[model samples]
Target chain A: MRLRLTPRDTSFFDLLADSASHLVVGANLLSELLGADRAGRKAIAKKLADVEHAADEATHSIMRRLNSTFVTPFDRDDISGLASALDDCMDFMEEAGDLIVLYKLDELPARVSDQIQVLQRCAELTADAMPHLRSMGDLTDYWVEVNSLENQADKIHRKLLAQMFDEIADPIQLMKLKEVVETLELAADAFETVANMVETIALKES
Target chain B: MRLRLTPRDTSFFDLLADSASHLVVGANLLSELLGADRAGRKAIAKKLADVEHAADEATHSIMRRLNSTFVTPFDRDDISGLASALDDCMDFMEEAGDLIVLYKLDELPARVSDQIQVLQRCAELTADAMPHLRSMGDLTDYWVEVNSLENQADKIHRKLLAQMFDEIADPIQLMKLKEVVETLELAADAFETVANMVETIALKES
Candidate 1:
């Protein structure tokens, strides 16, 4: 039997869910930046930055709450892990967009867009799953789906790498694209890490 | 003023300290691989892998102990953070070395060696600081110095990126070198993260 305590503030899950929503916005901005005209690139990146800042604020709230609240909704470690992973996903999205702006790449490869699509799905899935934590409901599907998306992203990433080396002839451009792709890959990896954390918590709770 | 309980296992610190020491060995092998001739590259990478496997074993031991022990030497979060960061450092080092062998580069630029040297210093400093974690004695300098080293690495990293764009001609070669340099940069970043974790623990304990 498990001892249950009513959380003074259920707002923790709300904040985390809000952060995940921010990631969706950031992911969309990134995907849009890839296909958008050159003139609109900076605007997209700035919007992505705004989303990242909001996520940062949300993460700080979680941390502050974790420190102040004697009785949390779940383990402090799990809360912190989820918050940090969400923040990292946002950070990597912002980074990939920033690299595009910084490098002034006229166009990103099509597969890059595919990876961003995976990120958007992961973000949405995470947001949907956050509220369920209050009940410690079944999250196996959430994590399993996220992991599947990550594997798709990884496949796209590998193909992109091979294409970059096999076909791209200019060293400077290859270097620039490499950074963007790698950042995207890191975001995908961070999302999977978040899923893994959720799975760990679910196993411990259920 | 604070209540303390004697931990069932003091060996957790010993395991973590051992992992940090393994990082030093891994860093050295990485550095040696850069300077060594092609004939010896495989040997160096294999040695680095051995060190990584040893670090992995130590990290697993720490995790097992955390699961079993009720009263840990410090917060389980801090212990896990330190161990994960240490493991990440080793992963990045091995990655950088493997990229070298996979790329089959005849020679690496001098600044990469400079970055590896910084890694060596960071590894040594982390190994030195892990034991002091038991006492929660003055760790201000450890983190501060590690942060300083990271700054130096960032400088070297930026210079290398600029130099790569300015000097390197082959796109495929540039991609390979960039991966190695970025991995090394990540290793430095991981070290800073470990330092930051140490500082967090010290503040909480003190």
Candidate 2:
């Protein structure tokens, strides 16, 4: 490891970690929403919205700190990029949940749970990985695993699309489910984007 | 304008301008596809796919140059970011065209054409703005107009969605048209992202 002559502000890492933690909460709420009744889904989506708001605040704080500080732990743009990417993950997840509620969709396909499960795994992995940014150690596995998970999510998404097209006769219902599924896929993609950003940062720092 | 002592490599501007020019072609092809019948759409979509491939090549060229060159006219990351954003515009437009063919959508909403018109305008504005990067003159109008165009696209998108839900009784047809419309909107948003990145670069430069 290279040594630093001057101390860098470390709160950025904490703020990032905080931002990612909200994703975990949001993802879990999405999972819960999948299992809930309509009323239950509404409550869970509300909670997810609250978590999304908190995540937004976390991102804004990071941005505020980034602008105020001359020296950063890494490139200013990367910090903002990572932060924006994390916020995207939450926004997609929250949007998925809201669509589930708004469409009043009853009986989503079984594979949708599979989609949420992938998101949960991604969120957990991402949240676990954020604190490691300081040392930039043990991050290869984190990004590699997230990349692999995203592949799994993609396969699930394609299969789910095919299944929906095959089984659902109702187009409106299909539209609603497809939107939710696509939004979830976007969330998974966002997670991969974060992983990719982290990989870029790690390579640059190394 | 700030004066620089060191000579900067200028080919980046040319490559970027070339990239944006492809967007004009792609967007126009999209407009043609909307007007075409099934056979014509397939032919046009094939052509659009070719354009998308060409755009991809342009983007890759930018990346290759970025990697090989030491001195760039602007921040290396900003150049890459702008290139990627431009590529996204083509991807979404190409996807919209492909879906139009794949789903065999016959009668699209009038507002769908409105969406493409907005994309056409954004593409023209973006293509026009890219050459100005060398001088960094008259770019504020470009980004500002693109931003306003994106807002118009969003409004059209929401109205189209509501209209499709209210008017289309065939669920499958609704699904196909809605996907196409949303993808076009994504193309519009990608243009805005490019504009936003340009704005950021211009600010930093100024």
Candidate 3:
């Protein structure tokens, strides 16, 4: 079950999706640095920073749209919650990247990239849910998928952290690994928040 | 320029501070283990767990009080936020203790114990601020002292974290040290959140 909305709702929802998309790219770019050169890692981190900055701008626009428009998609708090949740995800991702750079981590493990991919897909799936949000419809599938991706990210995160302590020998590297992995997991948590909020809003609309 | 309230508001405020006071004692007990016996540490951790459980119950009562009792000592949200924030501080403190046991961390740094003292003082200062929350009517002294204590805790948090990095030899220990210190900082951050909330309430009341 869901509620129906006009084109204006569609536009705002689309922009929100776009904002999430940019943030997802930023999060993935952070992981994309795993098998990269010192220069490559540095470059990717910068790209992440760039996208992160763009995501901030997108969030501001979303807020503006939220304040001005009257007839909207879903509840106002839901819209605002979605924006803040996406922003939090990006914030955690960017912080993970910054930690990697700050701690001078040379090579990232394979699992970090896997989590990043999951994060990217979650953002994409969440975007897909937005159009559905415009019309009162079955959002169970969307919410479930978003949550599934986040759970996958969670698995990847736990494995990475355990490996950091169990397998990694370099103490400095372990320190860096622990922080980055925790930060990555926080991003997943942020995505989960978004999914949960969406499910609640969808239920309300229905 | 603060809103004046009756003594009844002050007592309602005391319940929140009293919960935090219990947490302060738990924190002191947790930190005392750095110099105590093995059995003592375990006992203290258990005691802290008990305090944490009680704090949650107190928080729930405060929330119920807010909802059912229309005329709160202060604004409903202000009381609500203070109660919740105190709970968060206790949660982090309890979690940090849980990690210590889970990780089997043998000895805590002296600096951490020092931070506990700072945190306890912050809690005390926080408790003192509630009576002054409604207005500065001869209460500027307490308000100013609360802000000063919060600033002091912030500095201690930063310095203690830096000292931790300089002292730990093992990389794994370094990782754990960083996590513990960050949590401690977060504990202090919780106090700061309360102080900021109190300050805002004071300003509005004034």
Candidate 4:
């Protein structure tokens, strides 16, 4: 047990967790969008957009708290960085969903589903890990796992790129699919960034 | 004149300037590549890669100095953030150049040059602004100009996208050209990020 003279504001943990929880919902919505027809995807995408807006509000709350608070649980920039990175996870997922509807892409490469699964797992792990910032314990596994998941996501992305160029005959279709795939890859990278920030915080605290 | 008890390490300014100078070389190389023949484009891209590699080393030096030195000129994360952002600008420029070569894109849309021109200006402005960081003086113009330039780049990017999709009939050609254009747009965004970081630092220091 540890003791402190000044009580640190701990609500950042809840805000961060709240922000990450959106990623899980966003990723699952993306997965659902993949299975739905055009009309269904449009509906699912709208829901995803609403969730993204909510996530943005959550991130703003974290930022407002960070600016007003004098004694932070961790470094100020790290708190902001963590919040922004979490927001990015939601943004990219939301973008991927939107592009699918905007481009009216009827078919996506099969591996795109693999990409979403990785994001879902990352979101779950990140949401689970935010509370641990208080203890700074049992975090090594979370970061390590997210790092490995990102690597897997990278492999899938490259392979999907190769597969798309090799098989997709219509150039316009190829363009739309490529953009959507790349956006999903960006989402995976964002999750990795969040995990790395958590690793930095945990290491500093340890 | 500002008086301080501890003398801050001033070399970070020079190191950052050195990193940013590579962007000037890189954006020039990219511009030159756009005008070159296929073989010439390949050679110019190789040169740009070397410049990018050198820029990477410059960024690493900043990171190493930041880690070993106790006192930085600004917030430690801000320093790292600026360094990473500068590196990203170079990376995106290099990728745009490389894709031009790899895809063998013979005739890019005319607006593509406008995108590179924006980058060239941004790079020059960024290299110029890094030294001002030491003084934290005369920086408002730098960020303001870069932000405006980014807005210009965004408009150019959207026009280029519409122009390409409208005029280019072959989907494959459009894919190659679009990737190059998007990468340049990203480079411009990265420069804006560096400018934003500078703005944050100057405000904090003030």
Interface RMSD (Å), each candidate? 4.1, 3.5, 7.8, 3.7
Residue-level lDDT of model 2, residues B1-206, one tens digit each, is 98887779899999999999999999999999999898999899999989998998898788667756767898877887898899889989998888787776888889989999999999999999999999999999999999999999999999999999999987777777877888899999999999999999999999
Candidate 1: lDDT of B113?
A: 93
The model with the greater lDDT, 2 or 4, is 2
Screening candidate 1 with a backbone cut-off below 3 angstroms (N, C-alpha, C), the clashing residue pairs are none
Residue-level lDDT of model 3, residues A1-206, one tens digit each, is: 67655445568768877877776577568657766767788888888888888988888898898889887766777788788888898888888888888778777787878877777777677666766766757677876787678757755765666566677787767767777887888888788777766765654554
Instruction: Note the chain A TM-score of all models in turn.
Output: 0.95, 0.97, 0.86, 0.96
lDDT of 2 by residue, A1-206 (tens): 99887779999999999999999999999999999999899999889999999999999999999988978999998999999999999999999999999999978999999999999999999999999999999998898799789868977986787678778887678878999999999999999889978876775566
Q: How many residue pairs clash in each candidate at the backbone level?
A: 0, 0, 8, 0
TM agreement with the true structure for every prediction: 0.68, 0.70, 0.62, 0.71
In order of lDDT, best first, we have 2, 4, 1, 3
Error of 2 at B73 (Å): 1.3
Candidate 4, A1-206: lDDT as tens digits: 89887889998888998998888899899999999999999999999999999999999999999989988999898899999999999999999999999999988878999999998999999999998888898987897799789868977876787678778888778878988999999999999889867865764555
Q: For candidate 4 chain B, which ten residues in a row score worst on lDDT? A: B63-72
The superposed Cα distance between candidate 2 and the true structure at residue A139, in angstroms, equals: 7.3
What's candidate 3's DockQ score? 0.13
- In model 2 chain A, the worst 10-residue window by lDDT is A197-206
Off by over 4 Å in 4: A1-5, A9-72, A75-81, A94-107, A110-132, A135-166, A192-206, B1-5, B39-57, B60-68, B137-166, B203-206
Residue B80 Cα positional deviation in candidate 2, in Å, after optimal superposition: 3.7
* DockQ per model, Cα: 0.20, 0.17, 0.13, 0.16
- Which of candidates 1 and 4 is the stronger one according to lDDT? 4
Residue pairs in candidate 3 whose N, alpha carbon or C atoms collide under 3 angstroms: A2-A136, A2-A137, A3-A136, B1-B206, B2-B205, B2-B206, B3-B205, B3-B206
Q: For residues A80-174, write the lDDT of model 1, one tens digit per residue.
A: 77888888899888978877876778977889889999999998998889888878786888988999999999999999999989988876887
Per-residue lDDT for B119-153 in model 4, tens only? 99999999999999998999999999999999999
